[model samples]
Target chain A: MDKKISVKVCLGTTCFVMGSSNLQELIETVPAKYGDRVEVSGVPCLGLCSIDWEFSKAPYVKVDDEVIKEATVEKVLKAIDEKLNK
Target chain B: MAMNTSTPKQTSHLKREILVRLIKAYLSDDFAENTRLIPYDMRPKGSEVPYRCCIHSERAILRDRAIAGLGFSIEETEDSTLLSELANKAEKRDVPEQQPLTVLTTACKGCVPSRVYVTDLCQGCVARPCVNTCKFGAISIQNGKSVIDPAKCKNCGMCVQVCPYQAIQKIIVPCESACPVGAIAKDENGHAKIDFEKCISCGKCASACPFGAVHEKSQIIDVLKNIKAGKKVIAMIAPAMIGQLPCTAQQLKEAIMKLGFADVYEVAQGADITTKNEAEEFEERLMKGAEFMTTSCCAGYNELVDRHIPEMKPFRSDTKTPMYYTAEIVKKEHPDAVTVFFSPCVAKKREALNNPNTDYVLNYEEVGAWFIALGIQVTECEGKEFKTESSAEGRNFCVTGGVAKAVQTLLPEDLPTHPVVIDGLTKQSVRDLKKYAKNGVCDLGNLIEIMACTGGCLGGNSTVNAMKPALKQVTSYVNSSKSIKEQVSGTEQVKQ
Candidate 1:
């Protein structure tokens, strides 16, 4: 089965400042791990920061429509794992 | 903007988040009211207090952060003071504080006092080298395990060096360990406190704290208020611009202009002036039989001399900084314009306050916040070409060995100028400088260049990029620019 999982890493100011810069590594690692099964790209802003403004779980990333808050390499990779397995 | 330190700490991210939010609030409709809502907005009623123990404690820390952001003294402010009131006061503030750093008392971890510890690896050997090596009897064998008495231990770390098993280790407070001047320490409450009298304003402690507690009193409100009032705010961008945003210099210029800056002048132009004058001064000093002279561009180094090593005053160069010369040129040309310098560290903020030509200072972090607040992408900006381009030497001033090399290139072939670079200031380097000053001669080299940050300005506390990438970008800029030797000769030919 050729599964298509699209991951959009939020590069917005809030996300970037909230340690999303570290997640940029996932842009490379995701493709290396999942091969053609996943497509990774950096998006400007998820616009979820203001929506989640009260408790800024900034640096959000979307893995196949699933928003990952307080994102990390491990968290992003785990999300990719669940989606791939699903 | 996001930074890419080899080990990017969460504290830096937390600090940036607060700055971005504060800038967003300031740009919003109701500055005072909105600024007050920051902590509540960030840590609303049911948020998981990720950092601190409780939501209330987290909010207290955020409140203190807001106080620092509004350019107020965190130590001086009463706990009862509301953020809304401070915002109003900040809006009307005419001048910034002289001290550049403020500690968030609630956020400081109040780390256990640094002491020599005997780890589990300790064999409790019969030689008892550790006990013997310790000048102070702080270590003793207890139940076949080495034990250290906190009160008796001087934290000298001699025992750590002598341990054969290497089981002994010294635990240090990051802020206290990073400070070269011994300016910051734990107070009665165990919260970090800075002795401003001894602080070199290097911002080492500000960047060192893991809790992101130390804050720079920002004049962002002052700069924004002027820009909002239709003042002609001209940005004097430092040589580190290329190392900041991912964009061409021309494009970065356009992006700065997009954010209400009437114009942008590369501080490198001022650095060129600094280079020429400093070269002349060095030659003059060398010819006068002086043994050596140090470069005077690093603001942190200048402050270190003023506060801690006054004896080195004579050997230090008296030339003004690049920001100074840049602001001078801007004022000379546009007398009515308000000058704002884009700096990479906190020392420049203190430096700008002293210079009449400079009106305000913004770190790379603040400028990044401003860009975010305005939703401006530098990479997408239309490139604006500069009328007069700077020499490679001027552009590379932010790099270690840049100033020394720039000066060395300008001297006559027979001048015998040997340049030595002090990569970064530390307790050892500070002691060496004092010794050099006391002896009135340096055997290492006749010309010494000392940069406070390890990799020069690119490694500054507030820089958004990592060392390798920043250096790569800056090197590209330097390679494309004309060399200083040719530029200097061209200018002299024109004058003749």
Candidate 2:
């Protein structure tokens, strides 16, 4: 019951306008399972637009300190699942 | 409508309204040739016309100066007083009228000839060096006196430099030369004056002037008015604003909230919505064989259309930019909420005015003033209210490929697609867009997303932070968020 995770999403224009902006909102509405651990906020521009090769590869975020380059809710759940298991 | 015979004064008022409308039409391009024939009633009538004191009305000496600066001729008559009244709309007005640069036109006898004021310091010491240096053959020794010919001499400073007496006079200043818009020029007393029309408000001349003659008008008082009213005020910030100050985003949000904004919303949130909408729009347009399309988000690009490429108007989308959309949503939810967009670009000011919902657009430089007036120390505003946007795709509106990235995220995984993102829309970039739009000739993609600014929003003309670091900060922010790392970030994603 002591599970709380800090989820920082780049709300910079590049991130927010892409899908991450919506993703940050989505995180707040996420089912009770991972909702409480997700602390979402918008930061300034981060240089991910440089490394982003594919459109699908972006609008990214991080859990704790690990970078999740591809922004997909399933990938986030996977990462969170691994952490919970550990 | 018939006028009552007893109300002669009311009829004159009606005529004034009609005259104002005619003047407006005359100043517009739509009536360039047919202005004389166009009736005044059709034009915006009455006190609706913005007015200010005629620049030349103050003095006859500066009349030509204003005319030359405005690139228009002025006809002065006994009715010039009425003309000034019309120009100023002093009697009846709603919006702030444009105050024309006040010039002493009555005193100016047109442009003064450079030779008229030549000093008598010609030593006449028989060296004849001054006469020899004259390229125009204007300088000569007449009756043992060095004289300059008014007709033959150019305003070139050669005569002034050669004279041992150092009597040559030049009215021009270095700051005036540096101004690309011709905004700065010498006043009646040879002091500097700024013409806001030609000025892009770039602040270049302000820095160039050794005398510090120019500074931007501050709107801190207006911002404070909204705060004091206790109406909900929000700061919708641009994405490139990251790392601008030493404080964290949370700290900054806290500081802004303390300054009296009921909430702090990220403009990135709007970008997310735009990305979602634009990506779909592009997919549909491309598949429907709309061969060439341009991004409509950039105000400069929109201006280019209105000024240079009116033919491409059909290609432009009606969808508003992210900032406008975000402000619209905020106003919709909170009708009383005054939205102030914090952007790096001055064009955003123009855009904000055009946007129906946005109340104000403050450049990053104004943020310091806003904080100072509120007595809020940004660094000391501990903790954050946690203002966040929708998704990582939404957050991508800041950089060059942001739109494309959002589109890609929205695309169904199994769809075979060649989506191309055209970054940094220069003239060359448009050529590239045409090449990609070619059917079967270019395999780049049917779907293309274009951004006019280099490096995208981060590279906007108004941002305070450099694009490189801002981009990095965005990336780091994205990498740190939890929901974007998961697959179900969107409601649509959940259904999928």
Candidate 3:
């Protein structure tokens, strides 16, 4: 039995305004091969902006507790792949 | 919000950003005293040259843009009035008859007209195929190179096709190339000017202009004023708006309410009504042995038929558009409420102006600006749980073929229905439509769905997201909704 990969995309004001609006749709469209293993959801605000990390941008995504900075479709997918394989 | 890498997209986005900032400032507490310096504040003394020849010229263009943002036509005013004075004038006026689109002459590049010319690659062949192929004697050999006579040339491009070197090439102005209705043409000074009669207000020209010279006049201030004056303003959200902003539809509704809208109604619900009505009308027409019925949801498509293909108007579905149906519902339920349509189209601005039910219109970009100016973080807002009784099919109206799909769902499965979908209204599509209208041909399909924008409403010029992502969002949103039967089963019939 494989564990479902939990993917949380930040939908905070900063993230949304910074172009995270498309990420939800992008996550929904993750390849059918990963469909059964990955679960994608949107968090209103990840509160990453409060953290002063240089890479803690608005569009932060956490794939199974591994927070990916400056997240895009490709970055998130890659993170999902790494977690699923791990 | 991902920065568009393209220069033209960036410039247009900047223009919208500046307008939003200006509108936000105007609505602030100390606006009266600081209004005069808004343009200057936006483009301070030492700002880098953004677009034009100099910083001053850029600021001038910004000033004109600010004026257009206030719902005033730049063509009507040349006065060196202060921003405060302009604001005061804007406040005094009723909802003015606004032209859907305007061009800022200051920013116009006055691009050269599209012309076929022999390039340096022209190898002056002894056979003179270029000269021989030209019916108008426009091509001649000069100094061992082919020369096109501008005076004698009919721009037929026959010589180019006949030339072995393929030296002849055509140069097209971006706005002229983008206009499907051929509304934009060069003036005496070579600046692009729109013929309003021929213009469908598709806004393709505005988006296509690399210089960002073309603009759609906004009614932001008017709508704001209405809100401030305690008028009950009901927002009729378009179907395409599902994925336009970052927030969910519920959150977006709450954010809209925070912007002082009395209530939010999904235009998708109205689309559901349109689907039912259009399907019934189609069946009736088919039974009556009518030629064909074209869907009438897209304002650009409607306008194209109205202005360019009047003969096809009879074949166009008599049912009202989703927006109209939505506005009808809103106006009837809340008669005093001012219905403001939030669309993803510039053509809808014109449509709203002509409509009695809809009092004002705002595109996704303009409303996004409003959200920014008001400091309304959409994602952070606690969304109200109000949902419309619109079906999945109705909400799917944002994408290409969505209408046909919705109509198909309503019609009987065994019905001999042949549907044709015209995804985008290009020159060739218009020609075909005109030919069909002239010939009264019903062989292709009993029902034809024509979307003016390439990807339907989601592909509207003012949309925030790109087409592919937006379509994905819309599709998922539709998939999550209830079926048409469940949504529209008990709803009262909206008066036509």
Best by TM-score: 1
State the TM-score for model 3. Answer: 0.84
Angstrom error of the Cα, residue B134, model 2: value is 24
Pairs in clash, predicted candidate 1: none
Q: For residues B346-425, could you state the per-residue lDDT of candidate 3 as single tens digits?
A: 99988887899999998877787777566577877788865556789888998899998898888987777888989877
Candidate that scores best on lDDT: 1
Task: For residues B1-496, write the lDDT of model 2, one tens digit per residue.
Answer: 4111111121112222222233333334543332322222222234233122432232222222222122122332232333233322311322211321232223223333224335666567677776788788988887776787878877677867776777655544545554444566766655556665554433334333433233223233345456656778888877656534435678878877876788877776676666556656665666677654445666545554554455666655555677877787788778978888887554465566567687766555446434432334455668575545456655666667666666667666665546566664444654554454343334565445565555666655434343444576777766565433243444452210
What lDDT does each candidate get? Answer: 0.84, 0.51, 0.78
Tens digit of per-residue lDDT, candidate 1, span B1-496: 4222334777766666677778888888888888888888878899888877899988888889889888988999999999999999998989888898998877776475566788999998999998898788888899998999988988899989989999999988778888999999887777889999999899988888877778888888999999999999999999986776556799988988999999999999888888888888899998999999999999999999999888899899888888888898899899999999999999998898799999999888788877766667666678999867899999999998998988887888899898999988889999999999999999999999999988889878887765665788899999999998888767762210
Mark the 10 consecutive residues where model 3 chain B has the least summed lDDT.
B1-10
Name the TM-score of chain A in model 3: 0.82
* lDDT score for candidate 3 against the true structure: 0.78
Best by DockQ: 1
Error of 1 at B334 (Å): 1.0
The candidate 2 chain B region of ten consecutive residues with least summed lDDT is: B2-11
- TM-scores for every candidate against the unseen true structure: 0.91, 0.48, 0.84
Total residue pair clashes for candidate 2: 99
DockQ of each: 0.28, 0.01, 0.17
Ranked candidates, highest TM-score first: 1, 3, 2
